[model samples]
Target: MTAPAPAIPATGPTPRPPDTGARRKVGAGLLDPRQLLRALPGALRKLNPVTLARNPVMFVTEIGAALTTGLAVADPSVFGWLITGWLWLTVVFANLAEAVAESRGRAQADSLRRTRRQTTARRLTGWEPGAEPSAYLEQDVAAAELRRGDLVAVAAGELVPGDGDVIEGVAAVDESAITGESAPVIRESGGDRSAVTGGTRVLSDRVVVRITQEPGESFLDRMIALVEGAGRQKTPNELALNLLLVMMTFVFLVAVVTLQPMAVFSRDFMAAAHDTAALNADGVRGIVLVSLLVCLIPTTIGGLLSAIGIAGMDRLVQRNVLAMSGRAVEAAGDVNTLLLDKTGTITYGNRQAAGLLPVGGTDTRDLARAALLASLADETPEGRSIAAYTRREHGAGDGEPGRDVARPGMTWLPFTATTRMSGADLPGGLRLRKGAASAVAAWAVQNGGTVPAGFDYAVTEVSASGGTPLAVARQDGDGPAQVLGVVHLKDVVKPGLRERFGELRRMGIRTVMITGDNPVTAKAIAEEAGVDDFLAEATPEDKLALIRKEQAGGHLVAMTGDGTNDAPALAQADVGVAMNTGTSAAKEAGNMVDLDSDPTKIIEIVEIGKQLLITRGALTAFSIANDIAKYFAILPAMFGAVYPSLRAANVMGLHSPASAILSAVVFNAVIIVVLIPLALRGVRYRPSSADALLTRNLWIYGVGGLVLPFLAIKCIDVALVQFVPGI
Candidate 1:
């Protein structure tokens, strides 16, 4: 067997300059502390026991605050009250983190709402026939009141009233209001690209839109809900981590409770020597105990867990990839293999006609006649190109095929991507067929036809030159089908596909190009595009079997499709991204739709998914690690006052116990505010093998998480002692 094809060279994502030219409506001001301060009361409102009880980590702080407040009220020392007050703010800080995330989304929602004002929709009442033909008459109504299934007319410069499918006319739509891309998109009636959003504007011409969704249920509403964090739910991983933090909090509680008794026992044992370092029953202040528990738990991550998940979804929307669920987004990160087809995906979707070839010493005109008649009713670009090429080359008449040649009761076969062929039957018992070389040859032999002398040579020649060869055949009632000729279709591999396939390889994902084209054509395109594997002449069954086989090995698979035949395979894959310009069956079967209709967009979705998972993991690692330093800062200060020897755990060597606890509390609070940008933007991702990424992240986030907090806590301690009045 010949050696496998070498992989294509891959590279980075399509580079885009900062969106300053068409800036996003949301800005850095969303993170302003002054804004957070203004939203504090609302943030605090969410900290009610009923709401806080849902979070295992923050609930511990909430309970700690209640106990500490009682102790501070009873204690005579002003120092005790100061520490107690700051500890309560610690709980508020966590609430503030969640509130800030919600507030940012709300600001963007305001901007979205401004574009969604109540507009007058032109509802079609009926039409009147005149000398110019039927003219449509419409009545004006509020866009918001327009129910689903209502027909509305939108002229140029008017906003689309609701999410709907275009039923009439073609126009260029400006989607920049929602997508942030200034380029206008062309939406036409019939065939895909008909989904018009409510907030977008029709730049030119007019369209009659049949509303498919109700006003509040439109895509814009879903986007607003997404940004406002209304859809955020606790992921399984987050719930598991929260449970672990709760268990750890219990362990710390037992330790803090037992330490007081241990200290009293030490004093009893050292009574003869009169050791003043021994802790007594009262040596452990209740306020200090509350402080220690609040400090030790994973509050930073716990506070921002929902915010992180919400941010991940927001980032996806900004990229123009609409995810149906957060779970689906998470699943994208785990895909091991991607299944894509050649036409419209690896190659730019123009499959054009280069020329025609006649076989069996037949007249070229006869072959052209058969190819054109077989394809006249075929609407696919390939079929149209064949008919057009024949007309251009052989001077065929401009009459319709059914109206001119093959008359009544003739059955027409539509081209299926699975069968890779199409043909027509005549009531007079004549038949014309065209399809992939092998498929047509098989069909001919099944009907008792023998292969023509140069059939294989013709196919081999076209396939060798990277052209799709469709074999044409003709037959009568009881006679064998004879070969007529070949149709040469040429399509180019898209630019940047080489780099995208290469990037998937580096990211530890195997990309396989599956196509209905012949094996030779498949191999040629696969080699040029640089995919890891290629499946040629793949039937729908073959595509499905391939996915099941890979999944049997415990590998997660992602696939893209746009045809009715592709729906089952798409549903079978782990992450299915369908083209918005594809058939409705394809969109219904997949979990996501790419409005831009780019086939290689599967790579972008995978990257976004991976980035979301990595971002959450990194922040979680940091949140857990920072707790180690908090323990170091709080535990020693709590015990140091009674047992001077226990002060050794104070690695930072702060000014006093009061100042040390204050600094740790402040640091814990401030860190949540500090990470909001990262939560929204997500962590940076670099394409590499999984093992390499793991090692790199372990060192960067894991180790850095362990050490960064120590230094941060120490810096805050030094600064607070110099400037803050209480500390």
Candidate 2:
């Protein structure tokens, strides 16, 4: 088997200068002092009952805290004051968890904002459509003044004023501000690489940009809003979990409310029987219903639920991906089928000119000149490679060795989907073209040129070897166009893809590669990349149909695309991750945007999503099991006075009833704060069978949760006896 090639950017390369900076780091530490300090104010503000009401569990805790505070003040006992203070602290700690998560995201947003400074745009005037002008009138204007459809000229070293498509010329753009990649990437007038972000800088040449976004509606604005938690909403799973918690809280509230009447009835019966030794009636009087209610509800999970959701989005942003909603991130965890583009996902995407094969009686040098001249004005990576190959093998004529300069009076013909060719119309009635073999052969036939012998062999050989063949041809005045040779463009499969696909397969995800390449080439590339399936000659309609078919079979489909034509299929997929550099239509249609524009980043997305789901699941198990142990610690203390034998239920023998009650509530509140870091960091994940994962969660969180709280509550009671007099 052929070894895979080293990976490059999905967008092809341009002429690069020396590196200016290293990759930008994403997100600060979860326990960063600065982030914690920033969160404190927000936490304090969230204490308002209106804001706390959004979380039913937390709201109930706050109400209980308020009731306890009133009772503590009226009765004025040491134990009452201690319990009231800890109850209020519990509400504050829950608010602090959510606040800390939001603060981390806010920090990321602030950093992004720094890169988007206001700049002036050289807006063009007197530029009529379809009119040929040597130059357009330039008007100095603020970038904010430029509206959609307005054209602006951005020169080298100038930041792109807004989100736009390149309408003319080609340039090397540095997108380090948003993508965190230091290498420069090419942005040309047409194709998938044409879309440029507002804050990226043009490092070389100039481009005529047609602004695509209005003020405050650019890609950067959307990204900032997402990272700052301004656009966060609960996912379907989160809503359902909250509903379950609310129901549990309601049941526990009723149970606690009925406990007081039962205590009164038990006391009356013992008094009538004159069994004074069996009952401590004073202990029944001391049972605090509010404390029992707070301890019983699922407070640990409720306190950290919002924090967990916020941290999930923050994790995606840290990975240089922006999700439009929490639902998209959650969906990524359950993606069963991943529909990937062949060019960038499996292969390096840069189809380079590897060789030249002459046809008929054409000389090697003659074919080289035609190919180089045809590619001189082409800015695509393949075009640049063709020109570079010609210059290196055959000497440059009257031009610099590394540079490509067009002759005077030459008209550059750019490649289009309809024409399927790019070339130059030279001086003195000479026309040169190079593109797909079929397109060039048809063009030659239309111009009265006969098909050259052995031309089919050359095209066949390139295609059979997983390479694209571009036929170079020329026409002079009224003379027929004759085919000269074939330019061999080979796209290499990316390295380590087989291994990555294997991992996905283990996780039960089916990988599919879709491309416009013919069957032989597609088959070879798919096998090389170890994908499960391949679809050759796939059009936008074909892609949409495939996604619909997968969904019909009850599969959750995920796909990555970066073109206007891909918008339909992207919108149809269960999880659509659009490249940040793609057209506005594609970006708007997808639910997530990959900042690095790496098609294979979806694999990483899947892992993050799984980690998020696993984290929530694990913490929930721990929270529910924790209540079991709290029951053992608090229940016996509440009723031991009513029945002497009930003291046996105090498995972790405590000094007194007051200490046990105080310890249980204290442990309940402190655990939320203790688990905040774990909630933010998320649970570690590995690709394994569902049964294995379920078994592991049961043992680690479920069993540990049931045991740890008993010891913690007992230790707290022992310490409370030493410090506090009443308890």
Candidate 3:
């Protein structure tokens, strides 16, 4: 037999060592801090200008007050002065507080980036005789020029420079930072069996690598991008709600602007023209009425609107979920439908051969050898698994055996996206090929033969249960083909998937599997996972259309994926959740990215989202309740109806102008202070049935909403009565 050809060259540029010495140290502290501080000005400029321009109610109120201030200066009316002063104070303080809060949030984000840069990069140099060059050499170093056994220096915590066999030393590397696995993987040198992650840390070992893969295209870079880029896309629900909120604010401002003249005309004109005593009394009453109207319109709702969202986002960060958009969390809570890509997201994305079936005159050993040869040049998880299995079965030693073999050839056809098959050319015009059963079966039928009975049986059995079925066949020099056997491959499911799926079901979410795999296999896995539905042979385009169909039915869909092909569907979903193990393109198309790549993180996020919505809903009710009371407090006075009949001494003897204004402001501010902490506490959640989670959130937000307003109002009333007794 011919010796196997050298491994295919890896595509992409070699990675350059990040400068982690002098400049990096300085940049970490001084440069990072200065950049963060500088970002504040830009952030402020971006936020304040937009908020001021877009928040019509605030802008109109400020503009109206300026006009009123000018009128007061010209006419010197006490009423104009009070209106101008009160409105200006409210606008100025509210806007300033909001700006400060947002700026602080941005500063916190900057700090996180600086923390990540503190870790150092390790670079390797040197070599050995007959050994490959080290991957950690400087970018300009040519691989062909290096002699064997040269010394290579690798830095601390830097990524491994290339795919290489280790020659020396040992280290505990944190591969979990990229792998989504929580534990650090241990690496040791001097063996053909040892493998290193390109970007992982060296910890405490000095080692030399025999470069296997070329420089820049290491798995480490791909993994890092997968983890970090998961937060790029905006969900449809978020986009819609944002537009709705903006429009609602606009409507409120329009009403305020149109009604301003009526308020001005309704003022006590006669009292204004009379003596100073009457004017002072009218001014106080006018101020009270305006305050009441402003309170009625739910201005306080805006204060708590994003409070729940921000709190939820903070909680997600704590759980290692970097939610890029607050709107994504909100959308997650409302997801009635979920679509999952089979690989990586649901399956481990690593395939292993469970068993092999033989056909015609071939035995299992022959089947294994052919499979191994066909897979020798492929580097996918499936191919690797086949190669490893073949070596183990054949009792091949750890290192490559020194056996000279001739090339068996007519022509070798590599796997491609279009063909979806691979083959090796043999003497006597025999071609050994392996691929999807359907494709191979079609080829068999076209060449005037049926697939062997055992082979057909094995394909039907494995393919029906979501297992990838690979069929092997041999075609003679210009005649028909004979079927060999089938290899059944399935992704190993994560341990906790069943329980997580159960929880999701209880939450009323209908889970659906969408995969490029055959329908037979898709259905089998869907049944095993307890999915509500399955779509087999789904392309990315098909996935997007399915998501739109579900959304059109009024179901909020959460789609999870981890490849460039999945980007469009992820972007189209109501909440796009990308795995930390996904491609950079997929990550950029997702609204939220799971840093740990745990599906359970999706549950955690959903609970956080529910808490946010409940908290915001409760706060809205509480803020509005306070406004309701404010309206009632000044309603009779505004109409001049109760002022005559119900004297102040009769009712609680607390009806003075200063007393009323103080009570309203104190009540509003106090409720905000007291409820903020409670709202922030929303709920502590763990993975559980959706029903149980939702019930818990409802109980907290509901009861808190009911009790807080009563306690707040009663406390304010009693305080008012004690502090200022008679009018």
Candidate 4:
């Protein structure tokens, strides 16, 4: 006896218990109140102070120092020249930088909007073509009135307007866009499993869907909620880091404020002497004091921290993987496991009839004819492949030309969830049906005979190879049905899949294949595809459970699928990777969307993700290193002028106030310039080997950090000597 099937847990939230019938309401618009508050300050700062002053706080501080210096020079006119010159430079460069960054961000958003507009929605009244206001109106208006039998026209490459039943035509729809699946699904009418989603594309053929739900309440809206709702949960690491940065900034500020008074008092005392010797001494003291303040402030961090992340995001986009969140991209590099759908992802998704085995006295042709008749109205790659093979073998026309012997005089029985099989009414007593193998096998057993020996063996043999075995039979006469033959269905593996799987294994990523196909077939395909694990006969819930299990084990899981059934699991995965050619639901659910549907793209994206993380980490490390050095160099100087024994002289004229101000400005500018090249070069890089990639990053980040700061300070020293002189 077969073992009892395990109960599959629900993939998503369980239905609200009867008492809680009310639905939760959410507000519209992209930015939430808290996010807006956090972003606004940064945006304003970007526009005004930081961007405008080149270094706003520093510039203001320099102005104050210059005023004091003028007071000592006994030439108050010099204060006006210094402040005016510095202010003019800051205004020009700062505004220009802010404008350029904003423009780039706006341009990218515009391109995304353009792509969204290219798609049109179908209305119940008629076909709404183009991205005009009328099309949206038609969608909104008809969305409320749509009913069953309403033909909604979904065009090639256009998102499906609503969740509906396929009434006519066949098409490959990319549900991945919505469901986070990495493959396109071929949809047709007359199967309980066939479902069309709103915001998925009709890739090849025009399709008509019978509306199932109202437009506003459709799956697309739910998907939007899922994506939007996810933002509330902060990753542990993100929260920790944010808190750390805040604390550090606070501590740095306190140090600067506490030390500032001492430096100012020392300068005041020297000014009171009213001698040339005292003025020069004060100038030297001011330089050392200001340098100390600069060190404590961690200015280098402001230049490098976010730049690394921004550069990483740009690199991902260039590789055709649009990372919606920086955290998602970072998580992808550390992914230890991947949950993949069997049909479009692991295989080519095109089912074909491998062979047919005759049962009892049935001939091969008769078996083919039976399979074709049963599959004619069905809409699945496996069913279509069987029908096509039959037509090709018997020289029948493309259309269903012969009478359907099973269902005589049957007009229609649209496949419903209760039936599990489709049927038609013709004449006499006949019922044509095609569905799960176990169901068909049970029917044959009740008929008091077994499938012929050869046929049974063939079914078992194909199932062992991971091929779905579909039994075809017809009922003749008044009561019992005669077994005809069996059809073996198989999805062809895409080219280069084996090699890519091997590469992924080398990278220490474990691949898991999940499918609704039976265990025998699933195992066969898994072995062929080199998957580390396989879960067969899985419902949508089963797939999601597996994903959660892996994630709970501390593995960062990237899930790839292209169906409505895959959406929840995709969302649950650490990195939901949707195919560009998948349904809109999948796309919205995914963290990253690949423009190309090739599974190999996953490997490429993972590598890109790694590069991004490494680059960001390196940049952070460098920025922090510079911060440490600045603190060491300048903090002592601030205290030195206050302590008589610790007073350092400007013996080489290097520690003069003017020289210190000029050096800090030059140091900041050089660091920014140096980082620009690093960002540009890092983004353009492609690694041939993991070791080489790691080594290169280490050298750039590790060595560059140690060397660049000293060179920058030295260059500033040399330039100051050339411009200013003192004995």
- lDDT of each residue in 1-727, candidate 2, tens digit only: 2222222232234433221112312222456556656788898899999999999999999998888777766666666767778888888889988999988888888889999999999998877544465556888899999899999989999999999999888999999989889999999977887899998999999889999998999988988888888889899999999999999999998887776557554554335324223123333233356777888999999999999889988999988999999999899988999998987777767887778999989998889888887776565678777877776766423342112334556677766778888887877898888888999999899998977999999999998988889999999989999999999998877667787788778878999999999899998788888999999999999999999999999999999999999999999998999998888789889999998887888888877787778888999999999998778777776666566577798889877666777899899999998888888888767776567777898899999899899889988988997887645
| lDDT against true structure, model 1 | 0.74
Q: Pairing residues by index, what is the TM-score of model 3?
A: 0.54
Query: Mind sharing the TM-score for model 4?
Result: 0.58
Q: What lDDT does the true structure give each of the candidates?
A: 0.74, 0.82, 0.56, 0.55
- Pairwise lDDT winner, candidates 2 and 4: 2
Q: Write the per-residue lDDT of candidate 4 for residues 1-727, one digit (tens) a residue.
A: 2222222111211222111112311111121234323333444455444443444333433443454455435532321233234333332332232233233334444443332322344654544433344544334334445554556777687777667767666788876554445677777765423567655677897776777665455544433332322222333443454455546655755665576576455665344323324234434444334344444443444443343444445555545566667677678777788777777667766667777877787777777766766765555556556666777666433444333323334553334456455433335666555556666666656765465666667677777877777776566545566667777777776656666667567667888887888787888888887789999899888978888888788889887765566678778988888765455556667777664545445656666666655655566567666654343333333334445443343322235434444454455545643454454234334433557656775677667776666556556657756764430
Question: What's the lDDT for residue 681 in model 3?
Answer: 51
Task: Report the lDDT of model 3 for residue 280.
Answer: 49
TM-score of each: 0.71, 0.79, 0.54, 0.58
| TM-score ranking of the models | 2, 1, 4, 3
Scanning candidate 1 in windows of ten residues, the lowest lDDT window is 3-12
Leading candidate by lDDT: 2
RMSD, one per candidate, in order? 10.8, 8.0, 13.8, 12.8
Model 3's lDDT to the true fold?
Answer: 0.56
Runs off by more than 4 Å, candidate 1? 1-45, 76-78, 120-159, 168-171, 202-208, 254-284, 351-459, 469-489, 535-552, 561-572, 580-589, 640-648, 654-656, 717-727
Considering summed lDDT, which 10 consecutive residues are worst modelled in model 3?
Answer: 21-30
Choose the strongest candidate by TM-score. Answer: 2
